[model samples]
Target chain A: MFKLLISLALLLWVNTSFAISLIVNDSVSFSPDSSKDIRNIFTLQQTHWENGNKIQVFVFPDDNDVHQQFSKSVTQMFPYQYRRIWDRVTFSGTGLAPTIVNSMEEMLEKVSQTKNSIGYIENIDKHQSIRVIILQGDENEAQ
Target chain B: MKHNKRYFHASLLQKGLLSLLLALWIQPAFAIELADNIQVHGFLTQGAFYTSDNNYNGDSDDDVSFDQTEIGLNAFWQVNDRVDFSVQGLYRKAGKVENGDVRLDYGMMNVNLFNDENNHFGLRLGRIKNPIGLYNETRDVAFTTPSILLPQSIYLERSRSLLVASDGGQLFSKHQLGDGWLSIKLNYGNTHNDNDEIRDQMFVSYAHGDLDSEDGSFVGQIKYNYQSDKYIFALSYADVTLEYDSSSRDLIPFADGTARFSPYIFSAQYNGEKLSLTTEYYYSENEFKDFGAYSPDLSPITTNWYVQGEYRLSHKWQAIMRYDESYLDKDDRSGKNYEAMGAPGHMGFTKDSMIGVRWDIRPDVMLRAEYHNINGTSWLPNADNPDRKETKRYWDLFSLQMSYRF
Candidate 1:
């Protein structure tokens, strides 16, 4: 009976702990701004930071679980939809696609080390190289 | 037998060249990183098509036809934060419609007049893709297209050359308005036209004439994206003018004339977690005068629309369905007046129903299969199927394609 209760608690903890949010290089010092503003950056529609520095975007592959979760929870979009947008603009010579990393660790390493870089992670850890920017609305809004 | 040998040799050369280009494209992406902001990308697509009755591209009526292939290589050099240069080279062979020749797709310089986090204004000079509709800019890229073929009602492949790109300039602006984003693009230029194919499709018979583009033609589109970019609405308009200079051919008894085509399209799309829906409605007016043999008193206005839905079945699979309709004359949907004029009634409209599935074989490779049930042959160009009078009213088509990108 005790083992069953402990297992159930562990599953709940795992489910609730996957809190996804935006993570940017330490150079950014913005608050919960408009979701539309962030969408433009991630989509490569917007390229410059307010300070006139080119914004580099890092992301995981389309099928990555955390990537999908971040897109849905933060941007309220499907992974394929986001990918299609990138393909349209990139192949058309109208815009560029974000740099894709193979894993979340690479995403963190790239986003943290590169200047003006932005990315997302689940349960982001507190680090001097990166800062977590809370999204404007409730993360559960995507549901 | 000589013609067959030439065709075989041409296909062999195409294969060898594409294989070499593919090898170059497969080089390490990190090598492109040597140049700070230079990015190179390319795509290769090959399709096999079979039809139940009528032909679609090549001899696809009863037997499988391998007449469609698209290859492209594009590069972008961000010279500076405020300026960039882009170029793309493309080779496409779609039956007689595209003659499998390498050509420059788009080569332009983009200068950002003003750019910040919230607002952007830019000017593009030289050859640029016509920003007419959502799919026109990247129509040749199979990865960017929703299906093996785009909805032909709005993006008719018959006159693709005239609508694809222009040698002129464009001005574009994007701004964040309250909770939404607004983007506007305007282009002015002269576009290239395939004279023989254009004449064949426009006039009943091939007119021995040269098609010339009138200067000052323009295209514009305004797009509003809201709801965190999940919803998009766009309005596009274009005015295309062509003048036919008749050649001295007794068999082609045609006089010099001018043709004007203007079209307006409204598009909307909604993206959801498991489903995405898209719809577009367009109205077009085409006017031709002083053709000697064929002339219309007034412009004929046509209407077309398509409703498409896609459902993501899993991480690697998707299902799609779309219904597309077009009428040559909105007021005469039955096409009786067209039939009375000695042309087949079905020539005035087209209705197509398509169902398809897509699988992402890998991140860089994709496989697609689709079936289409079509009524009417309005969109079929005479170049592909010369016997228009014998075209059946109802037909079915099936196609499969494999596409790779890097």
Candidate 2:
């Protein structure tokens, strides 16, 4: 019975953990030079592309499952931390916040349609123009 | 103009209640998005306070009083790629001290001068929020703070107007360093006028004259955030000056003086997924010169510090504990210098220990309750406790607040 319980707990943990990929629009040809660039972009530290086209970020809401995993796995930050950063910037009139979508499908759609936009999705859906950018480092060593 | 203030206060409280209902019914529409890329955001926070001995926010001597309220609305308009316009209107009532009034919180046009892959820089002109410590800029917003009352050792409530915002220019820059980001912000501006409360605190209501900041103040800060805020360290400095012009009809002898204050702060934080640790230290040198014939020039170096820890119990619940300390003069930690002049010895400093819990009912709504065990009257507003002698050396304060934002 103990072995069965342990196996069930492991299964539950595995079912909850999922891989998230960073997606960019078709107009973007270059990816982040380093892992820090990914964080800088999403955290509003980096606002423009190297070519000067402004980056319009789209993402799921803070409570969304995929968004939570993406923040911890892909961006290597907690959802609450991102929320705090966004709220501080927004209220203090320091910077702008990303457009929050409702679902992963909506995220995929927005990134594909918007120019120079970036977001994360659990898996690549039916999208011809949106490209998935492979992050450089492991999530554990991101800091 | 006599009954006008009471009428206005009543309306503001009504507005606060009205918006609270509106938030509950229409949660999504709280954030209004315009067609031309303009986004509107705001927050409403209502608090109830009860103190075991002293007064806070209202007549809270053993009675729950709902006198602290903050209502604000801000708009961000992306005018173009290089410039954005931001404006906000605030109505705050923080006790008998800060009566209800509609004031412009901040109105600025941030012009993006330059940006590239790894660096971004900007110049913000107009009325801007002063970047003090981590929570000064967004102090009034309840959703952004961990507890109802922030560490009063540094973010003092009496000097709210002087430290809140400035009407001048600010330059901000962010650079991506090796495995981290470095941000620097510098501000130079004249403080807005509202010195009656501050003057009363300093002179015990003796100066019935105008007290204002004639010279512009300067504030600058540099911060390095590592690993997307797993670790953070910051250094902030400010030089502020004020002048008090005494009137002939005052109660006490005429005392005209200039006060120069320079405060240096070092802040550090470690943010983990479930727990966070933060500590900040303040070293301030204050000089008071030329305050009449009898009063000698006095310069005191004040010291204050606080250490806090926050643990996330779950996705929507959080608990925080903090120990904050402050001294009017580091040399007179025991308040003997002031006791020599016939005053409560405990009034020279304050040591506060607080514990709080927060429940995020929804993404836009929050409920929080906190208790503070305080050992002095240093940071208490003079308006709340007019007779400082009646205050208890060891007192307890309890507060509850509900906040909604989008």
Interface RMSD of each: 2.1, 1.3
Evaluate all candidate structures by whole-model CA lDDT and list the values in order: 0.76, 0.79
Best by TM-score: 2
- In model 2, where do residues sit more than 4 Å from their true spots? A1-17, A125-143, B1-19, B22-26, B340-342
Expressed as tens digits, the lDDT of each residue in A26-94 for candidate 2 is: 666555444466788888877888888777788888888878876776567899999888889889887
DockQ-derived CAPRI band for the predicted complex in model 2: acceptable
User: How many Å off is the CA of B329 in candidate 1?
Assistant: 2.5
Model 1 reproduces a share of the real contacts of 0.52
Report the error of model 2 at residue B385, Å: 1.7
Least accurate 10 contiguous residues by lDDT in model 1 chain B = B1-10
Chain A superposition TM-score per model: 0.70, 0.71
